[model samples]
Every structure is written in C-alpha cells, then in structure tokens.
Target: MPYTVTIGREREMAEVRALLERRGDRLISLVGPGGIGKSRLAIEIAHASADLFPDGRYFLPLEGVFEPGLLLPTIAYVLGIRDNGEAALEERIARALAGRRVLLVLDNFEQIVEAAPLLVRLFDVAPEATFLVTSRTVLRIRGERVYEVDALPVPDEAARGGERAMRSAAVALFVDRAQAVKPGFALTDENAAAVADICRALDGMPLAIELAAAKMRVLTPQAIAQRLEQSLPLLTAAARDVPERHRTMRAAIEWSVSLLPDEQRALLEDLGVFARQFSLEAVEALGAGRAWDGQALDGIAALVDGSLVKQTEIGGRPVLSLLAVVREYALGRLREHGEAGRMRAAHAGHYSALVARVAPGLRGAGQGDAVVELGMELPNLRAAVRHLVHIGRLDDAGDFAWRLLVYWWIAGFFGEVRVWMLELLGKDQPITPHTRAVAWFFALWSELWQRPTEEVVAGLGECVRLFGESGDRDAAAMATAARATARLQLPLPDLATAERELAEAVEELHELGNAWAEAITEVSRGRLAWLHGRTDDAQARFDRATEVAEASGDLFTLSVAGNHQARLQLVRGEVDAAEAGCVRTLLVSIRLHFEEGIAYGLEGLCAVAAARGDGERAGMLAAAADAIRQRVGVFDAEAFTVHTPQLDAMREAAPAAVAAGERRGAELTVAEAIAIALPDEERDRIAPALAQW
Candidate 1:
C-alpha cells in the first residue's frame, strides 16, 4: 500500500478483520499515535478485504484537506459523484452507493475530527457501505468500533541475541528497512544488540524505525543508538520523498498537537511532569493552583480522545499515560513555557503528600487496598522522590521514603528506596533527625539479608538511638525489635539478649498502641520460641500474633503468623491443616502483593507436598518460591535450613521429576506460579485482581 511491506501487525490485522466482518461495526476507526503505522495498516486491511465488498474499495487520502466542510466533498470526489446542481452532495453520494457493498478508507481524519458525525450520517444513508478510517483520534460517533494500533513488539534484554533479536517485529522491520537502504545489511551477532537498542529506544514506532534505519547508509546501528539520547533531533529523515511532517518524529507529533484546542494543549504540557501513569486524583492535585484547575478532567478526556494520552485501568481505577516520544515533546513544550520547574515541584509535592496520607493505611485494616494503590502509583512515586532530591528537598524526599516503608518492603521496592536513602544520607545538607533515622533504617533493612547480620545489627542500633533522641519512641521500639531479629539471624545468636529485647519492644509497642509493630514483634518471639524447641510456647506466641494481626487487620503480619503456624502444623504431621494454612496465607499475600510473604507461603506449600511424597509438586513449588525470593532479593537461611532436609529427601527419591518440575517452575511468572500453588477455587476468587496485576 505504501511501497513497503507491512511488518509485525498480524494480530492487529486479525482483530480489525474480525471487527470488520461483524455487520454492526460499519464504521471502524484505526486510532493510535502518529508514526504508529495506522494509515498503512488501514490500507493493507482494505486491500486485503477487497473481496468482501462486491462493489469496490475506494481510498480517499485526506491528509492534505484540513477543513471540516471539505470532508463530504472529498468523499464525494473519491466516489466519483460529481456535484451537478441537482441534489445535495451527501444525498447524491448516498444514492450512488445505496445498495453497493463498498468499503471507504479515509486516511488522516484527526485534523477534521469535527466532521466525524458526517461519517455516521453517511453510514446511515448507505447501509451497505463500511467506512475504514485511520486517524490519530477516535471519531466517537455511533457504530464506530475503534481498533487501537500499537507499536510493533521489540526485543527485551533477554532476547537481544542475534537470531532471537530478529524474532521481534520491530527488529525485523528495522532489518528490512536497513537492507533497503544498504544492500546486504544483515543482523549479525555483533550489531544485533545495537539494533535492538535502537528499536526499543524509538518505542517501536514504524516511521521512527524507518527513519533511523535510513541512517544505515552511513552510520552504524551503534552510532545511531548512541545519538538517540536527543532523539527528537536525531530521528529526522532527509529524504525528499517523505512528507514534511513525517520526515521527523517531532514534526509528526507537532502536527497532532497543532490540532488540539488551547486548553487541552496546555493541560498536556503541564502533565509532562509525570514520569509514568497517573491517576485522576493525581491530575486534579497537580492542577489545583493552575489556571485550568477545574477543567483538568475535561482536558484529560480531550487529550485521550486526541490520542495524546493513553488511558487504562489499574485496580479498577482509571490511569493515564503518554508515550515516551509524546511525553518528550510535551516536556519540551513545558520547558519552552518555563513551567517545568513549577509543575515538577507541584508533582513532587502532591505525591509526597499522597504517600504520607496513605502510610498509616498500609499498616492496618486498609493494608491490601493501600498496597495496591501504592503499587499503581509506584513509578510516579519514584519520580516524585527523585525530583524532590534533585531540587535539594532532601528532608521531604527522606520523609516520603520513610512514610512508604511498609509499601516499599511489600512491593519489593526496598532496593530502590535503599538507593534513594543512601543518596539522601550522603548529602551535606541538614535533615530532621527523624528523617535521618528512618533513612538509615531503610538503608540497613534493605540489605539485612544480603549483608552480614552483625553489620545490620550495628547499623540498626544507631537507628534505635536516633529515633529515641528524635522523640519517636514508637520508631525506636520498632528498631529495637528489628535489631533483636537481626541478632537472632547471627551464626551464634544471642538468644537470651534477643528474648529480652523483644519482650521490652513488645511491651513498649503495646503501651504506645501500635498494634502493627506489636504483631510483628510477636512473630519474632514465635520464631525464637520455635528455635528453643518449646513447641507449646511457639504455638502460643504465633496464636497471639495472629490474634493481634487479625484485630489490627494487618495482612502482612497475618500472613507471617499464618506461615509460622503452618510450619508448626507440618512439624506435628498435620498435613491437611498445614496445606489449608499455607493457602490462606497465600491468599492474604496475593491480596497484599507481598512477594516475601508469597514466597514463604509457597515454601510452606512445598513442605506439605514433600510430606505427602509429591516430589514433583514439592520441587515445582520450591523453585517457584526460590524465583520470588531471588526477585525480591531476600534469603532466609533459617527457613532454608528447616526445609532443606525434606527437600533433599524428595529430590533423592525422584531426582529427574524434581529437576524437570524445577525447570518448568523457574520459567513461570509470579502470577503463573501463584496459579500453580493455589487451588482452582481460590484462584478463581482471585482471578480478577490477579488479571489486573
């Protein structure tokens, strides 16, 4: 259709084809961002489906026509319906194609989107005709089925090898374009990674890939990729054959932005502060003091309609995002208007307050929902923290990081927070002692399992002093409990000291009415009791921990205590009770999206399977647990030692089956592994949430 073959759009083509086959979908709109190959895909679909329309397949190129009134006349001209002063143009066109099963392909309708209603009217008059439209925006008329044309799939890091990289649609397109520009150019082992990098950096947009590949006439793929940091300037094409707007990625985006109303355009520029997806609440907060404060929602809808912003749901709440290229363009507009600094400060302030407000909820009854909310906003949260730190607001950054301590720990974001805290602690500027103490605690806790237990205990001892001196007795007691937990992990653990400190910490937490911290302290005590071979005492402590966690509605602590009880159940040879306990804990962990808790639940299930002589199932669950542990950067030597003996016996009995199951499990995602570990009924109950994840 465009002198080049289409690449990597088979799924889209099939989906659009299916829609077209449906009689109700008379008006099908292929909508996406500029350079996403919408026009090309529409032409290919129309050409391929020529047989479906018995009359004819007509193509009308509307890129040059910008006026709304010219649209009807243009369609009339394309259909060869000359205006002869007899009837109206629409009537004549409808009469000419009334009974004909024709297909009309309208290209570039975004500039004249106001005329969209005319297409519906035309469709009403000519019942047998189907209109296939390619636009940067949706038409929003009746009977219009929008098919979003996404960018081609690019190779991820794992698939960046020679032949593996070529499997990507984006890479294949780039190779085809490169060979056209420079004959015999192939994807070799040496240059494959560079090509993959270029494709990914360009976000897999077709026009951008073609433009970059055209540079193969002189520059290497590596050189082109290196220059892509300033991609807006580097992605221009010098070919006179290409349209002026299509010659550069920037011009293509500008053409779309030029068609927007002033309010929507301004809102888009202001929204450049978000580094990732943002919620409507976030949009409202960021717009609070701006001139368009009350019009943000309407403006966002308009931007979404105009294809400048992408809208999706996370946790059943709508979230908006911009493509990397579009965001870059919006950010450039923001800088040109000199509002980048002000907007970025507002964004950071909003997210900082957001995390602070949700921090308490993460520790109590709202733990599950709060964790999901924070997880949904994590990218924005990270961006906010980085911006705060960048603008010399170390105190605010550290405070925000500390407030989200529970969320960070649950979502496996502690490593990232550890880096931010390290940067904050390294700064020469002064911060509040409370912030300093929390920052040190985060830095130490993130590496508690990776680093030596002695070092963690020593660092946490300082945190305890800082929190106490800063008048935060709750934090001080929490740190005291953490120090004791670390001591219990040491080679020759000071059991007596750990027992004394835990007892003191629990009493302090209880007096302070901090049930969440008290629950955690009890779990530590339960672990201590179990180590001492005091089965009755251990069961009592775990039961108390569970009771406190349930009272406080702390899912994290509940999962912890539940897993501990499950381990005791297995020790007592109560297989059924142990399995039930592990499944219950897994449901709680999945609800909270707590990777560590999920891994522990899997480990408990693995032990149950081993006890039942299901070697394959045990090995599968164990490998899955290990995968989560590796991803979360957590290792529990004590727990590993407890399970090691049974796991070894299972492996020894059925080595091949265990090895095969381990390989299969290692390849599963967290969600897939959860499916394997859960019973069908429980999985069905959690399907909706897991699907969102």
Candidate 2:
C-alpha cells in the first residue's frame, strides 16, 4: 500500500469495499469534496480487496496528467503495457486485461474528468476488469456507482454534554492521532467538552480534525476550540462563493494558523514555500538577517503545536513538513500578504546555501550523514527550484538547479534535474551569464554517457567558457575535466587531447587551491592513465587523489579514487586488499547516500568474488548493485563495460547458483544490501559511527 487510511475511516472503507467487490459495478467512484477523505477511503477499499482482483490492483495517479489524451497511456503504463503506436490504446488495454481480473484504481481522476467516458469504453471491452476511482465530482457515466464519502460523524450539541460525545468517530480519531504526538492525551472530564466542541467546529472533516488534534501537544482543547471560532469564520465570510465544505476546511486551517504569534505566523507562511520536508537549519537560514530572531525556534514550535506543521524524524534528526491542504492555505495567505516573492526568494537562497555547504561534506568521514541530510532536503530543494521557476525567477531557478549538479548525479536525480533544467532554459526570459554557465554545466553532467558524444562535447565547451567568463576558476577546471572525459568518449577517441586537457584542469584546480576539484580531476587523470595502459601512473594518481580528498574531507572524490584503486588491486590479485577497500568504499557510499558509489563499490566486490571463483557471492553482490542502480535511476555504463568479463566468467561457472543469488540480492533493501556487503564485525563497528552525524 502506498498510503495509509485514517483510523476512523473503517465504516466508510467497508462500504467502499462492498461497492468495489459488488458484481457488475465495474465503475465504482468514491466521491467527496476536498479533504473529505475520498482518496484514503478508496485506497483502503482497494487494498482490502486486493486478493479479490487476483491479476493485479493497479493504482494510477492522474494528478499530473494534464491532457485527457494521456489518460489511457498512463493506465497502460501502470498495467505495464507498452504502446507501440500501432494499435488503439484502449484496444491494447482491453487485450492486456482480456482474461485477467484486474482492478484499475484511477486516483485523483477529478483532475482529468474529461477522460471519464473512456472508462465506459474500457468496461465495455473488458468485462473482467474493474475500475475503482476517486474524485470530487461523480463520473456521471451509465451504471457508475457513486459512493459519496462524507466527513466523519461529529456529536450533536446535546451529545456534546456527556461522556457519549467522546465516543463519536470524529472524536475517537482526534484522540488517537493526538496521542501519537502527545501521549496521555484523552477525553477526561476536564477536556471532553473542549475536544467535542473542536471536532464539531471543523464539521468532523477527517483532515481538519487531524490537523486540530495535532495541536493538543501544546494547546489545551478549550483554547483550540476557542481559536477556531475566530479564524474559520473570518475566511468563510471573505470567500462566500467557494463550496461550503472547502470553505470549512480553509476555515479550520486558518483558525489554527491564527493562534500563532506574529513571529510564528510569519515563519509558518515563509515555511509554506516548501513543498516537502525541510530541516531546522534550512528554516533558520530562511530567518537569517530577518526580523525573526531567537523567537524563530519558538515560532516553529508554535506552528507544530497548532498542527499547521508536522514534525517527523529522519536519520535521528527532526524534520518538519506541512500537509498539502495546510500548505495550500498557507500559500494563499502568503500570496495575499504580498510576501510570496520574498519568501520564495528566501527559500531558493537557503537551498542554494545548503547545496554549497553539503557539497564539501560529500567527500569525507561524515559523508554518510551529509548524504542522508542532503537527500532529506532534496524535496524541499526541488520545491524551491519549482517555486522560483513558477515566479519567473529564471536566473535564480537556473542557479538553484546548477548548485545541485553533483547531488543530482550522486543521488540519481539527474533525469529529474535535467527536466527542470530544460524547462528553465526553454523559458522566454533573459538568463545571466553565470546562471547560464552553471545551467550548462549541469546539463553536461546530466547528459554524460546519456546524450550523444557530440552534444555532450558542445555542452561542455559552452559550460567551460561560461565558467571562465564568470571568473570561477575552480568551476572552469571542473568543466575542463568533464570535457576531457567526454573527449575520450568521442567516436574517434582523442587520448592525447584528453590527457592534455586533464593536465591543464589539474593545474588550474591546484592553482585555485580547490583541493576537492583537484582530487576529482586527478581521479579522471587516473582513469585516463589506466585506459592508456599506464598502470603504475594510474595507481599513483589514484593514490594522490585519495590523499587530497581525505585531507579535504571530500567523501565523493575519495570513494571514486578508492573504488578505482580497489579495482586495480583486484586485477593485480591483491584479493584481501581489494576486498577491504571495497568494504570501506561501500561504507562511505552508504553514509554519503551516493547511489553510484554504492553500486560501483558492490560491483568491485563482485569482481573480487568472481576472480576467486565465488560465483554465488559475486552474483548476489551484482544483483544488489543492480537494484541500487535501478532505484537511483543511474547506470554506470563504464563499470558495466569493465566488469562484463568478470561477471560473464562467474555466470558461466555457476549459472543456476548465480541466478538464485541474483534473486536473493534483488530482495535485499539498501540497508540489507549494506549488511550483506559488510561482515558482522565491520557492520557493528560502523553502526555507531554512522549514526554520529
């Protein structure tokens, strides 16, 4: 299940399940207003009746589908049916589900209601297929069964007078969720009326009640109830044309938000610029040099207390987030106050600073924590980029995207970042030379080994020139190294030219005192030397790169050089040394959360195992690497090409055992993969150290 249902949606779940399970009711729709729990209820029903479908219960999210024509293709994608453009998509879908009892759950279908009629045709062609949908509006198609999901039941005024009110489904859910945040919360005589009143004020909407209950950690139920009376009505009067249910939801959010002091309110609105989880430090950066002071921490606490913000723990550190509903409301308030632009600027600036801060840490001892922390912030980083782009801050957007080039490559977000970069570049706006240079560099990195060699070469040329013009000697050298690497990858390889370029890049980086970039350039030189059959020279470069990176505390560069060094040792039959280096590199990769590093490290171990005739272990490790690569959206083609001989040898030696090992590896999660790659003693020793950051 991708999402969890609310505690009190049980009855609604049962009813929805009955509709979905009922024969001939192929198009059953869960209908409700925004924040009325329709999607959660539908998901619950789909999950509960998973076995009843037998073939598969495919959930297709249509929120991102803006064009109605893309609807069928999206469904085909979820069904794993590729469209060859030769046949009608509907026909292909019907043929695929011909004899299978598949359940197609089209979620957020309201956004693409124009495509609703297509479902009728689908049902007509495939009687065994069932369509389970969630939408705010009814499909209005023939035989469509609409299960109108409503707000959770709230106690009447009379029921609010006694203990019976505490048992109301809405009140029960509120208490349950509240206890999750603040344990010992209950419907005692001292707070029972307050709880009941709060639930009723929000009209028993599940999202509203949950948001309100989250406040119980700090505010008394009576205070919450009283605050709601003020904020909800103010918005209701201002937005009369909106649907009553939506207005109520907005009111509930506004009421909670209104309880915050001025500093807290400003912080909440500013934080709303984020579309995903953010760190405390990131929020503080937003408040830096502002009127927001030491009280900013108190502001965050207040927002969390009011349930306008949600707090979560990642890697033992607290992360804060806002629910989509609450975020939308906050954004509305932010825009209304004319603070949207300034706050978004702050958001982008903070993430840019974050990228620069973490970029250095990506190489050293605490690299794992740095990776985890940066990975956690990726969503917010992306959100900041999108916000900047949305507001026509193309220069800022490009700069923001450029700062994440290393991160996107390491974290396997190149495809996503590439899309963002292309969109930004496509915009009809003037771009500053520095931002353009950064954008081009990002494009070059993303297109590495993925794009045509000529395109990659051109992008690198432009990137290097722009970086030089921008007076960033370190960045220019990095770009020079990339161009040299690309030059060797060209159709007619230029080994001489690549060596010349690599030498110049190293010199430039060293002169600029950018040890990190210099180490990176050195690693490239090492790889080039190895390719040219200069094994001893390659080893020296790798060793030098490792030393520089270690001194600079740059884990990414060290991992690169270390992995290559381990491969060298393996080829030279230094089995113990190779294995030890691989383990250490794997640990660094895991800590840094660098997927490519982890994959390459695993592959290095695979090579060692294959060389030692340990085909089974080789296969398992290869499978683990493959899984990590697939998850991270990366493919280290160079590593694959280099290891083909070894992997083939292992497969040929023990084909069946290799197959079983691969299966075992496929089942391993990232943590499990780490555990399998490292010995028990090594893992135990690293465990406490890994958590330190």
Q: Write the per-residue lDDT of candidate 2 for residues 1-693, one digit (tens) a residue.
A: 322225677777777677666675888888887777776776777778877897778888665454566577567545644332212456766766777788888987887898888888888988898888888789899879988888989988777554787668888888887886788877876787888888888888987887788777777889888877767778777768778888888777676666566777777777778755777777787776555656667778867766677787765778787765677677887899998888888887777777777766654455556666775665676677777887888887876665555555455444445556667777768888777877666656645654448778878889889888988777788888889888877777788989999999999888888787789889889888988889889989999998998897778887888898888877777878988988988877665656677788888888888888888888898889876554333333554334557889889988988888888987776677777778889888777645552
Best by TM-score: 2
List per-prediction Cα lDDT, in the order shown.
Answer: 0.79, 0.75
Superposed model 1: Cα runs more than 4 Å off: 1-247, 251-262, 313-316, 572-577, 612-641, 650-693
Candidate 1 has its poorest 10 consecutive residues by lDDT at 80-89
Clashing pairs in 1: none
- Top lDDT hit: 1
For model 1, residues 590-616, the per-residue Cα lDDT tens digits are 887666778888988888888888888
- RMSD of every prediction: 22.2, 7.3
